[model samples]
Target chain A: MEKKVILDGNAVAASVKESLKERINLLAQEGITPCLATILVGDDPSSETYVRMKGNACEKLGIISKRIHLPKETTTEELLETITELNEDEKVHGILLQHPVPEQIDERKAFETIAIEKDVDGVTSLGYGQTAFGFGVYPSCTPAAILEIMDFYNIDASGKHAVVVGRSPILGKPVSALLLNRNATVTTCHSYTSNLEQFVKQADIVVAAVGKPNFIQGEWIKEGAVVLDAGYNKGNIGDADYESCAEKASAITPVPGGVGPVTISMLLKHTVISAESYMSKKSATL
Target chain B: MEKKVILDGNAVAASVKESLKERINLLAQEGITPCLATILVGDDPSSETYVRMKGNACEKLGIISKRIHLPKETTTEELLETITELNEDEKVHGILLQHPVPEQIDERKAFETIAIEKDVDGVTSLGYGQTAFGFGVYPSCTPAAILEIMDFYNIDASGKHAVVVGRSPILGKPVSALLLNRNATVTTCHSYTSNLEQFVKQADIVVAAVGKPNFIQGEWIKEGAVVLDAGYNKGNIGDADYESCAEKASAITPVPGGVGPVTISMLLKHTVISAESYMSKKSATL
Candidate 1:
């Protein structure tokens, strides 16, 4: 009759962080501290806050955060050179370049410069291809975190129809691949989609990443379907009309605290996992 | 009005080959003889024949196909080293490892060892990722060939519902991305799909790559939907029930002379294109 449950991404993120204490200590014992090198090109306020939060999260988990802040006038070649240095650093397990780099610098080129081994953010196409092919080292954080939340709720995606709105290389597309890997029938929609409502109504699970405030009408969701809102539009609004979706959805994720916290936590998780992978690969070669 | 157009892939392949003569000659003048290194790991008769056909096609197109055959007992490392050799070779512009490497060989590992620049077959994750992200230097041959056929027929896919069955990295997956890039709203279905008929019935375009003969029935297709059957099962059958589908489809491709010729032709086209790209990149760096 009413919304059955609200997915609390903050609580989930905390629980994940709580479980990482022992693993972090183990890495320290092996004389290999997990380090994440973050490159922030410009000082956009919101991006600054996001990077700060990531750094704080790493601090809490006993992981080292290496911050490299560059000026707005940074060029593509310089950023590429910095990324190359990080890629070749044995101590650096993961590389994160704050998105929306300066206008002069090519963002896609910068994303690709992050080596496959240290691509914890899953920004590279090679990383995505690995995910699609079913054996990726680390999937892009947001989508992978969404899956974690879904698993916490014991939602089995096998044979379910999942409609994912948005097709950004990092978010919508990779999430669709994750759902498919779980044997869910996945449909990808974009701005050009026709009769989007029809597809949404037939879906058993819905993931909205359209980046438009309240773009998905709550009434369009099939009753009792599981819904995930990955949108963070202006004024903290999400893609789904939360009030409307909460009335019908069996489970719904609230904006702000819903996806952001889980995603950031997954970023930390991926960094630690990347550190482990590097250790194993190094040991194998030795 | 039964099967108004057969969508003859063989004729299109021939036309494409004819158009490449001048370009091939122009490249020859630059001292760049478009070379494709074909690596066949075992002596499977069918695979050998396939490789031979590809070589014969290369000869006709003024492209040199260097054939490399290894014993069935070859290890994964051996194959990887061979691929690395081709990757670094200045004269080798493209690398094609015929599928179904011996059971002992790690086919995917060998595929990934291919350099992104030399991955003309588009078999690597990097290539697939590039395709999924909208602009790829080289698309996987079969799916890219399908796009060529659709263009030959002047089919505009913008804002259309394109339902693709199968999720193999090469055919179904990459084609779905290509259609999406062309502005088609794409839905990918697989063995785990539920209510596949519903999606197929509403599709403006349908591409079947499930690898099973007559896997898709005729009546499920919406009247006059654009259909592409990429299946080539035993007895030369396709995924679509061609006899039944031809009665209702607007355009359809036949099994033997349809996809096979176009796909093979595209392989040669890719090798030549790769050679040009190599020359340009080399010149740029020099």
Candidate 2:
């Protein structure tokens, strides 16, 4: 049996973080600290846990993590005000509004409030457009992570058939655009897509982002195709049936240790980038 | 032999114009005329013809046409200054910088300068992003025209497999995003795509936007597919071979009188839409 390559997220993430250290040190010498302001609405336990993990990751990289937790009843106006303050704060390098804000709050409106330069999470419409146009400063972290992993493993997307399942604004759509920008033939499939498996069978690269565990069957994967599962569902399972998919895949990402870790690392990396850009601009003007 | 339906651009364009007449009249009653400002740099005969045709189209619709012709030696700064003046002009509802400005000018920068509200041609990066997000006020005229034809012919894009050849920023990319938003499974294929025919063979609908004449072959199209040719090459030829494709297509748009006419109509339509929006905002303040 031929040994399949395990595209390890931890190793990829370590490589990314390892790269940022030198840049982070360079910023420190300039008396600058890359700061990320994470705004979390309401007290969903998972959201809290995710927020803490992000802050810890930033601290570990010598970056500042400013966590702003709003009450469940926070209004859209209130949230926008908070984002505006962050946008104006010279110390803040990036702003991330954790997904799924409480019902009353207008989520998209909050996202739009993030200044373009500081939108490290790449949640704004302008960022999405720039990403599609192949000149985005910070693409959504998960999508960026997927590309980073592929780069680490030397998986060339050019001239390949990349089928992306799901069309979430932050995930599926942007990733498809990114791949297409890289010269891959891209097919964007969603819930309304019929005969989805047939499309999957044609893919040289499969990106599973449907948010449902085991949604993609092994039989759907083309032989020797690279599979990057971006879904993290309940019980540490991914969007694809790992065991069966691994059997057919030339390279596969394991769920818990796959795309998740690298996603946070990308967020950190973007912050450092933002800080570097800010310092350069400040120096140039002086 | 089964007869194929000819998706007539003249008929669809007339319908769009007819619908806009009432809105144009409503604005006229308020003593306001919708205006489009078209900027042409240098004397490219084809571009001059296009600009004149657009200006003539605006005049026929009772919309004011403002034409700005610059010399070949015009700098990017000069073009941007012109766009800025028009963007600030309340009378100009839409602004179009005809494609392919002189090589010295930065085209994308000029496109970006068109105020989002006045970007009726949908050339701006923000407009493209908004179109991808499915809420853009105005999409690129050609892409919008493709959707207009589909709507006019009662062709539903939902759940269909749409293969778009070419990945041009304004045409191919926006159309793919439009179709995806309509719940169609969209594949964006470019020159880099290997086995292009196999992908085209699977499409329920084929959109040919590649600039080459007769680039998409008849045999590559799936049986009973709807073909939309957005390409208008030399001698009025489209991207797909008309005779061969029409033989296999259930419905097809002809090159000369197909997407071309409707594209101009969409520009007219978007200008009217922008004018209406402007009026509503004015009335609210009053």
Candidate 3:
């Protein structure tokens, strides 16, 4: 059988941005500018890089970007107050809090404090629930991006056995729930799971999001199984051993060009959606 | 191996109700009475009977029971408005709209309209997501009832391969999610599933919620698997052919006396929780 073609995540994301320029223009004409508020705490190297990339994307899409820089010693109460202020800011259509706030902060509580309507990053439990139930709302950017790719590629997931090898609240759980909503039988395995290979060997689709580089061996993959590596390691290494698996599998997404770029694209898309919903709410009252 | 004991559903439910009375009295001292709102339309004979049973259960537990009677000709919008009214009513804690609303009404919309905070019955998508995620305010009563029964009977579901044959939003889907949360590998099958027997035969636990009687045959069951039948069919029949499978299975819940009674008990429990929550919210301001 002929090998399936590879897809470049950055190229796909660029196309999505190109498509959104027209919508952004329309919104500007109507006197609405989509605004994204990015909150960064401490000077984590990777987080700074990610924030920079997102800000650049916002500029490219003609959306207004506001950056809130906080020190590493910031208290939970202070951070929450800042988020509350953003919630009340009419100009702010979406709020994005960079991950790994601080060791002293309650991350879950911080995520929950984001207004459900303004949770453009879709990190709140309510937002994740809405997405998992297919109620047509913003989903967490990365998982939503993966779904977009699957839909764009016309992959049929219904009735397929999907093994998700991570159980993180934000990524693994939500994505697994999403796959289940699409009629795929989903199994979520974590560090606590025994016999990991047994589960991977049975999946028609394998989604590795454990953050460990090359955690999934090529030998465990079922022939022709659709592989999605939602991991980014040092030097662009992925959760899956891509080189060996690419030769054996029918289709696989590369490390840097796979899920990374799509995440920001989905984030930009949500900014527009947030702007639209905010506009509709405002217009309805008028 | 010794034959497993079967408990009567009505007897189990009565025991649960009796145990909950002490808590009800304690809450009443604080001017709070666990309350349940039962909504019935068109006087469907079976639905009316079920509603009456649930209300009676509330009365027996020292809980308040409120009934909303609507005409058969009620439109989806009208029903939604009524539910919205109940959702906003302080005295109404939990709302139960009997399933299979008049054919003219959109059932899912009516169910989804119930506020998650007031959804003690746990039928809303929010409730389902919470139950699936194992962190929600309420779990769907039928699934909770099943888990309660298993707990009471000392049946361990951890690491079990649970094959749930049904994919309805309320029952099969939520129950499978609950099972997965409990560390079981759960596979949910529906009407469209092919080779259903293959999955059913491999399960350590089989939950048959498909309404068709005798849908799961005896030979398909493993020699010592536990069985939970949540089906309520006409003429008191269950999804499983009890006589044939009862002999082979290590433990089995009889149709009339198994999952049926426990569901009503769970519904009553949810009402109490809702009432407690309502009282606490009020107390917080005072």
Candidates' lDDT values, in order? 0.90, 0.95, 0.84
C-alpha RMSD values across all candidates? 1.6, 1.0, 2.5
DockQ of 1: 0.84
Better of 2 and 3 by DockQ: 2
- Across B192-267, the per-residue lDDT of candidate 1 in tens digits comes to 8888999899888999999999988889899989889999888889999998887778999998888889998888
Best by DockQ: 2
| Residue range A119-238, candidate 1, lDDT tens digits | 999999999999999999789999998898998888889999999999999899999989988998888889998899998998889999999999999889999998899998889999
The candidate maximizing lDDT is: 2
Chain A TM-score values, per prediction: 0.97, 0.99, 0.97
lDDT of 3 by residue, A169-267 (tens): 667877877787788877677775557788888788888899999989989999888888899999899999998777667778899899889989999
Q: Say which prediction, candidate 1 or candidate 2, comes out ahead on DockQ.
A: 2
Which 10 residues in a row give candidate 2 chain B its minimum summed lDDT?
B1-10
Provide the TM-score for each candidate, comma-separated: 0.97, 0.99, 0.92
In angstroms, give how far residue B229 of model 2 lies from its true place: 0.1
DockQ for every prediction shown: 0.84, 0.92, 0.36
Misplaced by over 4 Å in model 2 are none
Order of quality (lDDT): 2, 1, 3
Ranking by TM-score: 2, 1, 3
- Give the Cα-based TM-score of candidate 1 against the true structure: 0.97
